[model samples]
Target: MVIAVPAVALFCAYATASVTRHLRVRSTGFDLGIFEQGIRGYAGWGAPTAPLKGPGVHLLGDHFHPILVLLVPFYRLFPGPSTLLIAQAALLAVSAVPVTRLAIRRFGTRGGSAIGAAYGLSWGMQRAVGFDFHEICFAVPLLAFSLECLVDRRWAAAVAWAAPLILVKEDLPATVAAVGGYLILHGRRRLGGATVCGAVAAGLLIVEVLIPAFNAAHTYGYASGSAPLSGLPQKLLTVLMVLLPTGFLAVRSPILLLALPTLGWRFWSANPSYWGTEFHYSAVLMPIVFVAMLDSPPARSRRWLPAWCLAFAALLTTMLPLHALADPGTWRPDRAATATRAALHRIPDGATVAADNRLAPQLTARCEVYLFPFYPSAALRPTWVAIPDAPSNDPRSVAAREALPSLGYRPAASGEGVLLFTRSPDR
Candidate 1:
């Protein structure tokens, strides 16, 4: 466990620094703005921060995540989206603590620490770190901590920790129910049955009763929206992505069954996006697989398994783009990045602004920001606009770039492959 702390600390620091650099370089894929704005709203500091996730959608409507409220106070002190990134890093690293403790109890300090290091460096965790913050940061560590409690027979603590996942996302209820199933199988019948019932009740209440109650769109995003039979190859590949780091040994343990909830949802859904290993969708599965690996020791037990796990992680870490996130150089500024910053300076404080996904977070702190197309320009009547050229321009940005001039917004400035447009003063 000792090595786990420092290793996780370093991992968190790397992620925090990388995200800071991402911000400076005008890389907005990290979702810093979406969360920064949302948390800011929860803190009562801004005109409800609107994330650019979906059109005509409230931030709450994007996902039934009240967990954003928890981060409000931290953001109050630090007051940047980077705070969320750093918090996410710290929270994600924490899953290693309980996991390391479990390994230590079974394998002794040295061996357990090695396993913990592998868990800390798992591809899903690393990818999520590079991908930026997600609410799953809370869920990952909570799952680890709660599962550890279950392993140690601390039923109350496990239930307490496991219950809050309902606030994380729509899909977590099933994951929580699986945790109850684990308990029931292990002979804790009452707690197990109770947890299952509570999880189901909470999940239903949130999705069916609570969230849809306030959603502007009057809908919630529970399914992956996948069409029939198309996602099989992607599903198969995603399964490989989950187990390849541990040499596919995570499958041996019954604890690995916990991943089925998330896996089934992702694979069956029509959302082709969920079929890939990128993003935060698979974040919770990492700890499950890794912990299961620790629980089901190899026959030889001569350090072979742990060593192989670490080596496999190291090789993949070197090859993946996420490894680039560990370098401060990844955050260094470029022309388009600088130009976007300069364009922001031209817009007045508190003016309504519309921006592409990558540029929205930068403007969230000072402006009343709206994500383009999602919040129509006619209603937003934004005084200023920023559009990153080419790749960052999703359909919304393309439409805005074409429509802005006709809407009486003319070019204010252009830089970093982004065009800055302002509504004509006379209008």
Candidate 2:
């Protein structure tokens, strides 16, 4: 089962890569902007503020964990957005190995394989992998590896395992905290060391946050801007969407319940925009559930359960890409990306442009870029402004647009649901 599933996943990844390559010529979902920005940031040419952001925070060119930084030179060597898509696809597919190992460690080999296969082929994973090279894909394996080490009672191993996950994204600090707490409470002494490791992780996170916050304040002259704080209801809904699958499995299979909150909290608090858009993060909890489900069942029932679960996952996975193909807007290809990419190219390179969407910063690397929820001291300076078209059409977009010019910007270039403006050189 393990061999077959990954073999199938490799084939799927290859096919996905082919499709992405063909589509790359068109205005497409695979945005090279971020990757390009990242490469330039590594080369010390693009905005320094970008490296201070989410996944970019941890990049080390080729010197450090070559795995995470591998994309840097890969993009530099390949010089196209499709390279990023291909890399992401490959990572998602390879992540199946660790995920399968984690599942086997908990449930047994077959159950582990089933969970891994489902995850590898999920539409959400495919789409995310195809679209952008976010840190989430890289984090998945490290998180899984950490869990495997934790479950094995290898505290040193787990700490080593989790380091990469923690480094990949800022939010991962919370995940490390939760998992470390679980380890400590469960009577793992080495968890004491893990806790210390987590504390160090926390400190590093604080630095990442503080650096950006401080910079934003100094540069923009504000500590932070008000975006709608997701109200309690919205927060609750976000939690539910992130945890629904785990919740479903937990009810049917109770032993897996502990892992639900352990892993679910990460999803629940995850950036709301992440919901429905990137499924891989949500799928991260699957191995935990699969292991618990497969382990707790009676021997006879266990035999077929893994198969059934895999079958269900397989069916869903097959349907997602087809659905995406049938309705590009609803599925794999987002129109927003195409429209945004097109708009980015129209703006002159090296022109300063302020934007609400992070995509613009990455795509318009030749231009000076500023992202709102503006951090004050970003190393990059804005000379021009760009706002999402029809900001008033929605509250969030409106808030984003209104916030942009308040920092001293005025309109310059506008079209196709996007607006660009130049910042007053005097200011």
Candidate 3:
């Protein structure tokens, strides 16, 4: 079963990669940048020097997944973004094996297989795993292990297993709290200890919030400022779509009676700001629901629910190839990378550059770069600025151009809506 999981994951990953590859050559830049960042961070090079910013350490970012940090050393040795991405894909797929085991423990082997397949091929899982270097990919396996331990009533083991999850993303502490609360409420005594451990794990989360805050304060000269939260609704819709299959089964399954409320509370209370930014954080709870639903006593009327879900998923996967071309943005990495590299080559080595928020890190990896909105302590002023053509008409872009003179910056070069700026010594 374990061996089969990787095979299945590899197949799905390849399929996703194939689709994404065609979306645009540059879309892969984010994934590649993440891998590059990991490799650089691991090697003690290109990592953000300020110690705590972005996904590696902040609110809506991941910080606790030690596996990724550990992977850094090995990544340094191996040295290729594609290699890490493939490995991540394999691990994400292999997580289904334990999920299957948990399902089987709750349901029969056949039912467990169905649940495992659903989880393994879940859109959320597929999208996340398909990406090159998300920390969530590593956390998913550990989360599955924690659930397995919980089901076995091994509270100590569960808590210990969940330790790595805390580091993977900041919001995970809330998940730990949720699971720990469930254990304690269910009259599991050792769960008290686990709850305490989870609380301790949460203490580590301060780094996520604090580091970002510090960076914003020190670099941007403000403790807080507004960034667009435009995608919250879309993110929520995506979550609903991803969970539709499991949600349908939950409604019909008695064993999952508690899950409906749990899931509802989770989604309802979620911070709107975090919705789209880190949607993958929801992966941890997915298997628990799958296990509960599968384990429930047979409902004669609803026996076909799992089959229906699988059939629906199969249909979607089949049709994905047809729509692939229409969704150019789906090929994000390749397109983004090509664009970024082109922009990079035009900038002199060590030239300070600022990029669109999406492209900033990629550019940062290739050269000295800063984020727009101008961080006050950014290591250097940008001589070139890269903006996506699509967003050039945005108010922020206009505001940035307006603000440049005030900040002692002048436009130097322009390409495809991206502008390069040089600091004017006579500001």
lDDT of candidates 1 onward, in order: 0.74, 0.52, 0.54
In model 3, state the lDDT of residue 355. 60
Worst 10 residues of 3 by lDDT: 50-59
- Residue pairs in steric clash, candidate 1? 224-271, 225-270, 225-271, 226-269, 226-270, 226-271, 336-416
Between candidates 1 and 3, the lDDT winner? 1
lDDT of 3 by residue, 173-281 (tens): 5556655665676677576556756655564444534444534332322223433344556656745664575655544433343234334434454355334423354
The candidate 2 region of ten consecutive residues with least summed lDDT is: 57-66
Give the TM-score of each candidate. 0.90, 0.61, 0.68
The TM-score of predicted model 3 comes to 0.68
lDDT value, residue 310 of candidate 3 = 60
Query: Which is the leading candidate under lDDT?
Result: 1
The segments of candidate 2 whose C-alpha lies over 4 angstroms from its true place after superposition are 1-32, 45-47, 50-70, 102-113, 123-127, 200-210, 218-298, 318-427
Give one clash count per candidate, in the order shown: 7, 16, 30
TM-score of 1: 0.90
Which has the better TM-score: candidate 1, or candidate 3? 1
Please say which candidate is ahead in TM-score: 1 or 2: 1
Candidates ranked by TM-score, best first?
A: 1, 3, 2
